[model samples]
Target: MQNREQLWLELPPMSPEAPRRLLVFLHGAGSSPEAFAPVALAWQLKFPGAQAAILQGPEAHPGGAAHDWFDTRAVAADRAERAALAAARLAQRVAVLQQSTGVDAERTVLVGFSQGATVALEMVRNRPGLAAIVVAYAGRLARPIRSGERLDATVHLLHGEFDSLVPVVHAHQALRALHASGTEATLDIVADSGHVIDQQLIILGTTRVMQTVFRGRRRAAGDGRTLH
Candidate 1:
């Protein structure tokens, strides 16, 4: 049971009329919410009508400096257990954040990198009815969620062609599992890129996905559908 006291950040919208879309960014292992500050700033600027929240991981690392969403112990040995714990804990934190910020689950999008990507995937799997979209960069789905579970949200997997840390194969494996489970997913390959998300690619890919989600929401809203 991880403590929830240290797991949240609320980045308010620039305007009251800003779109209800909430983008949450999850950082990789050994990184804090500040790691994604630049990307969040860019998103806030580009989508001035949206609010972005970057959540810190729960597991604190050595030096009491950085955090991880889950204990990395036996990640390779017992990934299912690790992922399940992380998913449950993260879902709880997300629920609290939504209540505090007044963000609807159906209007929320999750974006993560590296280990953070794994956490996002698990969160989506645990609460498939929520999350409008999931954007994973240089990460793959945890095996627990890949085992025949159906994911309701659209997934965008962005991977480098030569990512030595996580490997391109991991992305392919996740895609295969997603397809087999009938999940809606789209995979984008960044040519000549590496483990780190390039600024240009992040802006391009994230903006495109956000636009798609907003468009769909608008269309739904026009149809007199309450997106809750």
Candidate 2:
């Protein structure tokens, strides 16, 4: 698994200037960082001030070629354990990226789908002060994590109305948990959608994160006026 972790990170192209914001994407089960290339490209174009980097998960797929954030074997029985393991691995990767790119921890956002979403939430919950925002799609939080802890960032939960894989009910439960924990979180449901990603939903999700980052910067500037 250590060697697998070393091989997991293959960063996409990026520029300097501190990257007004950084989006780190964690791919779902059986998928690689490549799966998020399209969305990263779209984000780069749509949010010029932000840069996107997709990180492959640390576990290799059984009898296959790619990597996964967590071992899916016992996910059904002990998802919280798997999520915790993945979150620890993701924290290492994020630390590496932050050290190399000189990006502020508060300017970084974590986005994921399916199992990837579970990993992202775990990372944020465990490392509360690092990430600026979290965007989770078609996923929920693992159990045993307290729902009364405060977070330094915001969270966005997106789930499909017809997602059979990870039911939308779980997503709502995660949202409620986050709120109970005193974290700022918003949940959005896509009508008639399934487990797959929707173009409009991606746009909406990414836009919300960008808007939050932009608004924060404006507030920090102390101009007494919102950027809008």
Candidate 3:
């Protein structure tokens, strides 16, 4: 299995005052929270009062000190079913976390890599508006979304052009799917890269986040203006 790695992680959302932003990060298959904390923290730094969580996958992946959200060896149909159920469970977890952290779905962000990315996308696919944004790295859409479903969050898909494991085509296909569903989304493919996250990818992801956050604020402001 491919091993992956991410920093002081402060989960102090339980403070008397609720945080304004919530970030939930998920590592790839055969990875743990300890391996993805740094990446999660990187995003948190951009959003003040944003509490972050590097969540561990629920199941143990055999032959390693890693965890998986669902079985990867199952047949395609079975794997899809398993992933959907996993996403459902995760959505529930997010709801509870939001209540405790005082972060509403509109202020929440979900970031995941590879299989973790699949689950993150799946959850929002099942719910349509579970969080305000999802930043998927080197991952594809695991389940089919209904046509023209109302997407409450914008999705950003980032992939490595030379990623053999997940292939860049998946990102293209996912973007198409999201577009057909009337969801606000974007895709960025990094050249000369593989399945792993590197400095270039990190910088690219940060740029996407900044653009989306600011654009959302502008739209919200426009909506609040009085019409003549």
Which candidate number maximizes TM-score?
3
Q: lDDT ranking from best to worst?
A: 3, 1, 2
Which parts of model 2 have CA positions greater than 4 angstroms off? Answer: 1-4, 8-19, 144-147, 223-228
Model 3 Cα lDDT, one tens digit per residue, 1-228: 122312113454433343368888888999888888777766655664678877777778889978898988778778888989989988887787789777788888898899999999988888866798998999998866676675678899999999999999999999998888788899999889999888778777778877887787787788995311
lDDT per residue for candidate 1 within 1-228, as digits (tens), equals 224456555577777675666888888888887777887777677666667878887778666789987787654778757876877877777777677667777777888888889888888888766677888999887773445678988888889988899999999988888888899887888889888878765876676677677778798899999753
Q: Give Cα-based local distance difference scores for all models.
A: 0.78, 0.77, 0.81
Judged by lDDT against the true structure, how good is candidate 1? 0.78
Using lDDT, give the best candidate's number: 3
Q: What's the true lDDT of residue 2 in model 1?
A: 25
Reference-based TM-score of each model: 0.87, 0.87, 0.88
- Could you give me the TM-score of model 3 versus the true structure? 0.88
Error of 2 at 150 (Å): 1.9
